[model samples]
Target: MAWMSWTLPTAMFFITIAVILISMTAWQIISPCIERRGFLPLATTRGDRLFIGLLSSAFIHLAFVALTDVNIAVATALCAIWMIVLMRWG
Candidate 1:
């Protein structure tokens, strides 16, 4: 197979996303989603929160990269924390 060019961080990012998607699918099969209200203005299901989390993560990364000299690691860490919060309570 011909390999595509990708850096370690890029490869890890896609791998992480794939793992999350697989786990989410398994969770859905094991227990169907039920909507709930939390910090968000409206009730949302797991899938909804996942989408919102991803958007917020992208926004966070963009803001961090554009506005500050902080390391990408720090930005990624912030995105991760945001994802966990959204998943748990958004």
Candidate 2:
């Protein structure tokens, strides 16, 4: 859309989010998950953990952008790692 700025990084971010959602849907359909407790304070299903991870990662990205002059790639990498850990054992 002309009203929106579709830069490469922005486009990639959205595309990645779409892909993850689609994949997660397929995964749930193939093998359903159950709620379980991890390092997090509450028991949660895979989808719940995913939602939390993504939401928190957004905050992490915003914090990086707002607070530091560091490169965005660093934040992205950190988010990726954090999400993986969260998914595995949140």
Index of the highest-lDDT prediction:
2
**How does each model score on lDDT?**
0.94, 0.96
lDDT per residue for candidate 2 within 29-51, as digits (tens), equals 99999999999999999999999
- Candidate 1: Cα lDDT at 6: 100
TM-score against native, each model: 0.88, 0.92
Report the Cα lDDT for candidate 2: 0.96
Model 2 residue 23 CA deviation in Å? 0.5
Pairs with backbone N, CA or C atoms under 3 Å apart (clashes), candidate 1: none
Worst 10 residues of 2 by lDDT: 1-10
- Segments of candidate 1 deviating more than 4 angstroms: 1-4
After superposition, the stretches of candidate 2 with alpha carbons farther than 4 Å from their true spots are none
